[model samples]
Target: MREARPLPQYLVQRYHGWRATAFVENRVWYRRLADDGQHPRAMVIACCDSRVHVTSIFGADTGEFFIHRNIANLVPPYAPDGEQHGTSAAVEYAVNTLKVAHIVVVGHTNCGGVQGCHAMCSGHAPELEEKSSFVGRWMDILRPGYERVTPLPPEQQIRELERQAVLISLENLMTFPFVKMAVESGNLSLHGVLHDIAEGMLEQYDHQAGGFAPIV
Candidate 1:
């Protein structure tokens, strides 16, 4: 086994500071959470982009939201091929085990993964089309979304594709039997949100309106 190295000084200092402040200040709350385990009411599937802060977006406290982050916040269609499905696994656990009432798939503007998918589909990123590229394979999930938005102007395609990522995930969530049953029974609700990284604005998908509208 490879030997593990010590954490960097900056991270160690940050940990110490957090431990001394937030951890110490909320010792009892933290202890209660540790003892009882988390029972978050909502599950947020968000992009792996560091700029998209799930907790901060909702002003959520620790243990309040079950979050899963992945490239472009995409969720592949339900496939039981007996292979590892990290995103699907998280969705199953959140819906079946945690019994979360809401599942929110959050996408963001200026997503690198989405841009890469656009490039690959547009034949601008031939390297990602290689068989060995994990990103290329994983990005197959967004191909349908990209196809649907292909008619738009070049400048608008990527941004629309980003929103489609959220919509696609929300649709894919229903592919899971448990997720479908929960939604059908009115026990679960699915939401799609797009975050504007530049303006720090949030737009929510309105089923009735059939498009995203800025939240106030």
Candidate 2:
């Protein structure tokens, strides 16, 4: 029988390496902010992708962005649906306690979650339904986006899916009363960012330019 420990031996070894690294670079940050608490300038809603870490992509220093990540970096609309809502709670804490000024819904290209959603929606991948996985429910968040791009070309459809996912998450941010009040009062602002992982490029939504612009 396997040891009842949560981590296997190799994982434990890698974690030990990470811990040693944490002791070096992260020590100063943990000392300064851990006792004082999280005071970040921005709150980033990012994906739980192995390649899309917000801290590393933006080169964030300690406590730079209060991050909330899920399968697809979703923020479900605020509702008393009798479910444990970790994302909503984190958003609330970021807005109410940390009082962060910016909330960025950071989406990325070549997202497998988005791909799964598109494949399921198009009805070509019926096998996805057999797994009884959270992928089904998580992909539901992209329903509105799916409806918007059904008739477009394959390339444009995928782009629309990714872009709309970010915009809808931005909309969901306003479902929280505190987030709404903060944005309305100019205490907070919202953004939709698209990160291209393969190209290692970052794009920011430029309202004036009417599209995404490369990070300068």
lDDT of each: 0.95, 0.84
Cα error, candidate 1, residue 89 (Å): 0.4
Per model, state how many residue pairs clash: 0, 0
User: Which sections of candidate 1 miss by over 4 Å?
Assistant: none
Q: Candidate 2 residues 7-92, lDDT tens each?
A: 78899999889878976777877888878887899999988888897888879987788888886777888887888888888998
77-187, model 1: which lDDT tens digit per residue?
999999999999999999999999999999999999999999999999998999999999999899999999999998899999999999999889889999999999999
TM-score on alpha carbons, each prediction: 0.98, 0.87
Off by over 4 Å in 2: 1-3, 15-22, 25-28, 127-132
- Model 1 residue 52 CA deviation (Å) reads 0.7
